[model samples]
Target: MKRWWIGTTAALMLIAAGCAGGTDAKSGTNRHDRHTSGQAMPAFVEQSTIPHVREAYAFAEANADQLQYIPCYCGCGSLGHESVKSCFIAGKKANGQLEYNVHGSGCEICVNVVMDAKKGIEAGKTLQEVRQQIEQKYGPQLSPTNTPAPPEGK
Candidate 1:
């Protein structure tokens, strides 16, 4: 009877320890908490249209501050995208690590914008210069509309 009691007590203690191991003592939250920096990571799309989308995402995360000043001409501003940076990053962690947004993977335009910014940075262009070049190329076309009306009548 004494041996049985001791074994049961040890089993109970092991179970308690296992449960305790999964929680943070200070925060009282799960130890595997996904929150990094201050933002919760956004769910990335399962598939990307471009093969190089992952590289574009990393580039955007690494150069977010610079990309933030560059605007996107794809009309994504309606989706709350203020700058090219918004195409990739949702927010930053306290340690400065980026929480990425999934928008870039699905939108070729966003990915292209990031790629262009990366190229500009690699070419030693200042942010202002890059912004100017992008604006000149993609800003309002020569005419208000680049495409003519479909046809006089179908």
Candidate 2:
């Protein structure tokens, strides 16, 4: 009976730990948290077929000027531009070779937009076409470099 109790206790503890994201084993975030703790974290982004990540970044950066830079109304307090990180692949570990982590940056909305845009681009959508799609999907209030708010006196 004592052995049974000990076994049950250990199992419960292990189960609890697993439930709490304790099983990160690699990146060590709360599983709930997008950011990880270690410098040598696993890749936070997924791999892309763009040949070069720079291209992907350029693609995202190009029309960034079109979207609005509103604060995340979701109360996360993050900016809309920050959501672009979801589009490109990032290395999971800081020094762990630059592979696409897919899980690192970007929110769900941003990720969906980015991935869709990427797909569209691959399917021969012009950059403008992709940007328009993003605008239509996320609204105009999501980009950053949006004409600087037309200045106060203008």
User: TM-scores across all candidates?
Assistant: 0.59, 0.34
lDDT per residue for candidate 1 within 75-109, as digits (tens), equals: 77777777878877878568766667777778777
Q: What shift in Å separates residue 112 of candidate 2 from its native position after superposition? A: 0.5
Candidate 2: residue 102 lDDT (0-100): 42
| TM-score, model 1 to reference | 0.59
lDDT of 2 by residue, 36-89 (tens): 222233333333333334333434444333222211212122332243442333
Separate clash counts for every candidate: 3, 19
Q: What lDDT is reached at residue 104 by model 2?
A: 22
Candidate 2 stretches with Cα past 4 Å from truth are 1-83, 86-106, 140-154
Estimate the TM-score for candidate 2.
Answer: 0.34
